[model samples]
Target chain A: MTDKKMDIIRALKRAGNNPISGEELGGILGISRTMVWKYMKALGEEGYVIRSSPGSGHVLVSAPDKLYPSEIMDGLDTSIIGGDIRYFDEVDSTNDVAKKMGSSSDEGTVVIAEMQDSGRGRKGGHWMSPRGGVWMSVILKPNVVPAYAPRFTLMAGVAVAKAIRGLGVEASLKWPNDVLIGDKKVCGILTEMDAECDQINFVIIGIGINVNVLIEELSEDLRSSSTSLSEIKGEELDRIAFVQALLRALEDEYIRSKTSGFDSILEEWRSLSSTIGRDVDVVTPQRIIRGKAVGITENGTLLVETAEGLEEIVAGSCIHG
Target chain B: MTDKKMDIIRALKRAGNNPISGEELGGILGISRTMVWKYMKALGEEGYVIRSSPGSGHVLVSAPDKLYPSEIMDGLDTSIIGGDIRYFDEVDSTNDVAKKMGSSSDEGTVVIAEMQDSGRGRKGGHWMSPRGGVWMSVILKPNVVPAYAPRFTLMAGVAVAKAIRGLGVEASLKWPNDVLIGDKKVCGILTEMDAECDQINFVIIGIGINVNVLIEELSEDLRSSSTSLSEIKGEELDRIAFVQALLRALEDEYIRSKTSGFDSILEEWRSLSSTIGRDVDVVTPQRIIRGKAVGITENGTLLVETAEGLEEIVAGSCIHG
Candidate 1:
């Protein structure tokens, strides 16, 4: 149903400034030219800007900046992750949606939303998810122990950093799962899972990227610490292209972690780490440790050389000192 | 509503062969004599045999072998676990019920069933749960890491073994979570959990004990490896009493694990261990290892001393050699 409309939109997108003829779209979609014309009218209603001249056919001017499945799937190069994408205009949390999904859902299924009402970070901390940000969660059924869950968070952080860096933007990973730009946070990763003692049932890695969000819209307290892509770049980013790259990068890392092991990805993580080699304050639930950030453990815990000794903090809030 | 009937049943059972006057039952229930008689009639319809005489008020002749909430709750002394028991005549699996339960469910909630249509062990291995067995799951939301999950399995094994031993039966715990009577298995535990890398959402400890199941009625292959309480005792055992004791024992161990850490329970597990100091073979998903079961690790993994030196097998099927 939406496939024909999507094919026309994709074909028009590929045509750039050139108009794609109705005959060509009809042949591509295996529909009649009359149907193609009807579909163009439908696309216009769906917020697609298509200019049609008397001599030239339909040319795609612009697409609505919506994270719809059709838009995200247009150029998504991933073979697994995001292949079965569920797009929501607004959701309480993409992680919640993924958690409630049945085991029958595909392993690499992804849930995406334009806005989140109750998005959260690790330990149920609130996450600010505006409409312009990429609020998404990827459902992965990795055959690993629940103890090894933080590895996925580390993997996702590396993927996000890699994708952001690929766009010529400088991005770095903070300890645990935060992506930062020069000591300000731009993205946070929350990993949740269900498992047995020996096996993992599934893991939902919630990734909240403040792409086109306005920094001023956040609470005053967060303004100094939190930053978005649009703020750093002084302009809004193409979220659709960013998401395609993110899903592709995430899928690549996820597959690599499964096949080669997490060490390779961990190496990439260390290279992009902003917390390592810095004096930091790691606050766990029990106590706060002031130390020089040393390195990360194989289990994805932060190893900090404190005044007392070297301490391995499994999960915590890392504050750059 | 059922609590009233349970109170009446408990009163009658306390009276033994002697009949409890209607006045006595009414006083204990805080109800009128007529109400007591009506409740007694209802209990009779639900398979309790009450012999009522004109002068000798009412004497409980026998209770049905049903693991009803009233039956199990009558003498259950647990402060936490089994406080909110959901009993079913049959279910696909008690673990499935607990897994499907919402986070709002109490931390120490219990789900019990008389039989499981598709009972499973670790790695989705089939478990034979007959009508007279105690196929149950206990839900615990411990504030611990997901890696600590296997410790709960070990804790549960010790609890089961201790409870069985309290009944004056010779029961021992095998590595990773199996309770054995001599060389045959009488109980198997499956601990499943939902957690993040750092915090646990909840853990459902599924325990399937062959209470009064007839060994001959089991599948031919299972008959040789499995033993039941009836086969050991040469008569049907009291399931209601056994469940009450098991729940109490489990709650004790669970609380100890939370308050004092799992070391104490680990010590008890080691004491009652049948696998330790025995020539054994442990089969894990990755490989098989034959060694003398030397000791158990703090993480609840089996420590086997092999020709290749010491090995810690986290999860596996243990076969006594």
Candidate 2:
């Protein structure tokens, strides 16, 4: 839908049972009275309840609760990140779509899906993406080497954790790219990049959050290990607002990473990390290492103090003891 | 274009000036005499000089000196490297084509072009790829993190140097990915990779070698800094034999790197290196580091002992002081 329809709906909602004149809307939106009426009519056709009178131009009764581009972009304050978003009712995977578009897409382009038929996790794992999850991917073009690419996963984790904590929830960061609510995973991030030797062409960051999914919606295996925001708060969240907050936080962190450095994001990640200081088992493709998760390196490698010594683990699945 | 045709041609060339009977040729190739006659007719149509007599079947007078897939694959000893090659008469860049195919291609899939319209060098420079040059790219699916990708460039350099040295030329390796003769570059390599988080999906190693380009054909600026095999050896080398040797050496080094480790390759690289022990200027995107090139790290980073201290540079352009 057009932003004008959204603006008209928002204006009528703000009026709160009072009638708003078309002239006032035209003045507010810098459009003609006829254009305002056209927008109101469009909004009414889109299931928005509106009433009109001779003197009172329009009044809003209710609006749809769907996550439309206009709804998500209503108050998005970032200059990038979500500036150009493609919304899909259903998709195989947002990451796949974003990856296909990444080479030619502008930096900060985004793709979001209402539901995914083939959502994926790290190492070719399947992710259960129900209707209530926020499945989105963003494209970024960073001027960095492939070695420094893993740090973007940490940056995304920190951004997601900060945004979730902003809603008064105790969200913690997991090693690599996960957000946890208490001991259960609430979000997962997958970062992929295309690079030519030392220079990166583009990176696609896929973020999937269980915003309002019910516990029963998860598969039997994941039911006990996964928690949604609605399950933690005992109520469904405003998904549009949550997504806006997340995009803003991610954009801010991305800017910080590009302009300043990743140190601040790394510090924030360390503060929210749930893996540090815990005895853990990290299973890499080659072998498994048991150790205390001591710290993280600048390149986003996990520093584990094992019997062998301090080992830097680049990739693995971690199990806490 | 077919292996059968190539087999007939190879057999006839091996006979020198003698003509073998069609029955014997068919028996040697496990085909009927009519099939051998058809292949001879097709080869003659493709500018190959073949003569047939009633008693003495067919004889090859001369064949075009082209780097066709059949020619390169004829008696190729590598188990991998050149097993599945996609040959192009002309292409924009072999690296670009290989990168596009990398995700779906097999581990040792290769792309080669007779001439590149827009061949590229490292750091956004143009590579002059004439018809006689070897412009090729190989796709590798290594089980390693993206941080270890630079070592493949070193491995490729070693392979190319060893192959050229086998041809009786004193070929040396430059830091990162250049094969040089004396102070001039005779070959350049560009490595690219796709990765997700901590795991690498695929790597494209693009190798461009100046095999038989004439010295006078080079641009005025490049003439002083570039030299070809024909220029150094005073004759046009056999393009098919050179590619076979290069692919074999590359496959050997790749297997060694995977099965044993990169230490042996590193030792060979160090011995062939023209940058080691030289006072060098390493120009990274961020800054320029001036130091004595003491050694190369296992990850293919240049170990530069600067005035400040020792520094490991992951990616950059190197210049000897």
Candidate 3:
């Protein structure tokens, strides 16, 4: 759909269940009245409930809940980060799609799928992304070195946790990149980058959230360690609203990270961190490091106080003591 | 070509211009005499100067000067670095091909081109890859993190410098990733990595060397700063032999780095470095750091002593002061 139609939808949404005259929409969109009527008719055909009366002009009652390109683009508030979103009903993984698209697509382009057939987590583990889960990847072209790429993952974790917390659940961060609710995993973030000699071409941030997935649908082993938003909130949350909130939060954090330093984001992340100050066993390929998670370095490395001394881990799997 | 054909060619090369009987070749290769004769006839048709005597069998007098897959693999000594090589007569860039092939290609696979129409350097600069230049990229699936990827460029610089110095040229290392003779650059290395989170999928080490390129062929601006081997030595060097030495050095350094650590490579790099102990200005996107190069960190970062104090630079373009 064109941006003009989206602007018209936004104007009607801003009116809030009240009718907006075709002349007003045309004036707002800088188009003719005939063009505005044509866009309204097209939107009506695409499952948007628009009411028109002799006295009242046009009211946008509701929009489709399905994550369609037009539906998601209708009310997006960001200037970037989701300006161009590709929606898929099923995919192998949104990250894979984003990686393929990253070479040609503009920065801040998004790829989202309802279900992933072969979703992946950190360290090559499988992530079960069933229906009702938020499986999405965002392409970011940040002007930074590869050494600083890990900090983007931390920023994303903060954004996701903040969005979840905004829904009245106590969401927290796990070391490296994971979001949890009361010791149960609710979101997993996998960040990937394509870089050459210190210069980064693009970074793909893949976020998988168990929004409304049922407990029985999860794998037997993961059922005990994972929880969904509906399970904690005692009701099914609107996926569209949740995704909008998440994207807004992500855009805010991403802009702040690029403009200001990561000091504020790091502070917020540390406060929401569930791993810091906890005794944990960080498993690397070389050896298992048993230490207390003292703090995080400026580069996003976890500073662990091992028996030998202080050790900074760039990548690892953490198991709490 | 098939590995079998390459193996037969290797056996012929091992004979060193001496004729080996067809029966002897068959016995050595565990193949029939007819098969040996067929392979010899095929190699002769492919620009190989093979002499066949009725009783003495076949002898390899010379091979093509072009960087063919068979010619490169004929007598390669490295165990993994060049076990698989893809050769192209002309390409946009070897790095482009290597990045595409890195996903499925095994570690140590190489992609080489005789001429590159659009070779690249660091910071999106164009590299002059005319004929007689060694334009190649190696695909390495090293078990390392993305932060450690820059060290591979330093290691490649060391390897290329060692290979050039072995030929009696005064080759030395530059800051970050460049090889120089005196004050002019002779080789440029671009290292790229595909990574997600903390795990690295693969790294492509693209090395470009101006072996026999004429100085007049370079662009007007690069002519003053860039020097080729032929320009310095006043004679063209053997391109095939130089590539062989480079691969050997790279394979050795790569193996040692994986087994021991980057400490040894760091030591060797520091010793050959022209930037260390010299006053230089490191230009990053954020700011310029002017200081005396003091040392290098284990992660291959340049340690500079500025007026403020000692500073570690992760990625930058160094200019001699």
Candidate 4:
């Protein structure tokens, strides 16, 4: 299915000023003319404005009023992000796609899905992602080792929180990787990275945002804990704009991580985090540590103060006070 | 391919006292009679001896001499190592398979391959694995968070070294995750784990051992830095016995990790480590720290004493003195 769409997109690009007949598209795609038309319609619905005239041919007129590949390629601000977009109608998980692509593809490749069939939260929990939510994963190649990958989660959280705030809705970062409104989770970010002993190959940042999804659309169990931008702002957001803003913010943080240092980024994370200074229970495989969250260290470890003393947490799930 | 093999094994076990004819096997396998014969031949080559009588059909005479699934099921000691074995004639990587299975499969499941098309080393480097090497990934469902994941890498290194030593080969631990023979890497362990804010799902320990690989077969540049058991011992070794020993050692360490404190394991690691008391360069993403390798912390961080002072190295590649 994806292969056919790529063919149509490539065929349309080749046709440029001239029109491509359905017969030629079919021949190129090795499909029937009817199947070609069906694919064209699918592309059109995805915002590809290919003008079709019966018998005459089809001309690439304009793309939809969306940040389609053509639009993203036209003038994407950063060097990465939407530089290479893989749009999927439905996928099990964008992270899975990004992880598969991590070895072969260039860094900064992005995978976007309209909906995720197996959207996941942290700790193998199901992430409630209905239609109209933004489900995407961005692939990044960083020189950092796996130990510092937690910072990518923190960086992504800060970016998502800032991007949500740009929509005029109050959003804050919950420690590790959640963008929340007051106490409800508005967005979640999962960072998956592959590393060698000393260096990292690529990291996939899977971000899910409840953009235009209504509170009523959420499952009853999650309704109280989950909120959407539209529900909070009383208006639907431009998802393309939101994605672009997020990519831009993410690019800035990624650049800092690569070129300058994480000191400023850590400072930003500290300022935006709601997890620090809270009473929390951190459950590791060894034992549960209940403590007051003190701070996040330079290496991206969570520092906790227990009755015994200060302990650094590298990995664990946290329960908020 | 694996699913069909398991079914065939199950069917043969169920029809114990009777010889299953080719026609019957074909009927049960939903494959052609020719395919049934081919699968049986493949199974026989893998160490399952079938007594075939032209008129009476085929009967399982005795188990073959290999550590194939059937034999592994015959009272394998470990809880997780042999529980779920994913055997592959050839794969890009067992770690890749384990990562795919890591999300859904139970802990202790193992993925083993006869050959890896794209085997890898730590830090995104290539791992030279020929057909005779023990290229496998063990899925561990430890309650520990992702930070403690490095400990698994450390434990695997210790296990591999111990298993190699059991074969009468001189082995030494090289800090983080390498088993060495006189400073040349004989085996490498890559540990990948997934975690949420405070909980871990599973850790995949991808181990690559040059069990029977000849040093002459190694890539030209790697020849000096890499050694194989075959080359070191001047003969081929029993891979099944080595795998069993490694798994047993791993089980002991893993059990101790759960029951007792990590003090004993850390002590064993310190004794086996060749890096301790040596001057080395630890290269991380941010900077390089040159110092004397002191000891390993319980969390698996490398403690180094630099000219400035003592420093803890969490994740990095080490260049030993």
- Of 3 and 4, the candidate ranking higher by TM-score: 3
The lDDT of each candidate is 0.88, 0.88, 0.88, 0.81
lDDT by residue (tens digit), candidate 3, B1-321: 666677777888788778888898888888999998788777777778887889777887888678877777656899999988999989998988887788779899999998999999887789989998999999999877787888899999999999999989999899888999999999999998889756689999999999999988999999999999988889988788888899999999999998888899999999999999999999988899999999998777899999999999987899977
Runs in model 2 deviating more than 4 A are A1-75, A87-92, A212-218, A230-238, A277-279, A285-294, A303-312, B1-65, B215-219, B286-292, B304-312
Which candidate should be chosen as best, given TM-score against the real structure? 1
* Chain B superposition TM-score per model: 0.91, 0.92, 0.88, 0.82
Q: Which stretches of candidate 4 lie over 4 Å from their true place?
A: A1-74, A182-184, A196-199, A270-321, B1-67, B182-184, B197-199, B223-227, B231-234, B277-293, B303-321
Q: Which residue pairs collide, candidate 1?
A: none
Candidate 1 achieves a global lDDT of 0.88
What fraction of the correct interface contacts does each predicted structure contain?
Answer: 0.85, 0.73, 0.81, 0.25
lDDT value, residue A35 of candidate 1: 98
lDDT of 2 by residue, B1-321 (tens): 888887888898888789899999999999998898888888888778887889877778777777778778879988878888899989999988987788778898889988999998876689989888999999999978777788889999999999999999999988988999998989999988878867788999999999998767777899998999999999999998999999999999999998989899899899999999999999987899999999998888899999999999987889988
Error of 3 at A271 (Å): 3.1
What would the per-residue lDDT of candidate 3 be over residues A1-321, giving only the tens digit for each residue? 678877877788889878889998899989999999899988888678988875668888888656776667657798888889998889998988888778689988999988999999986789999998899999999888787778888999999999999999999999988999989999999998889757788999999999988978999999999999999998888888888899999999998987887898898899999999999999988899999998997688899999999999977888878
Q: Give fnat (model 4).
A: 0.25
| Model 2 C-alpha lDDT per residue in residues A1-321, reported as the tens digit of each score | 767776777787789888889899999899999898788777767777788888867777766666678778777889988888989889998988887787768899999988899998987689889898899999998877777788889999999999999999999988978899998999999998888767788888999999998879888999999999999999999998999999999999999988888888888889999999989999988899999999998888899999989999988898878
As a whole number from 0 to 100, the lDDT of residue B190 in candidate 4 is 89
TM-score per candidate: 0.86, 0.82, 0.81, 0.78
- What DockQ does predicted model 2 obtain? 0.48
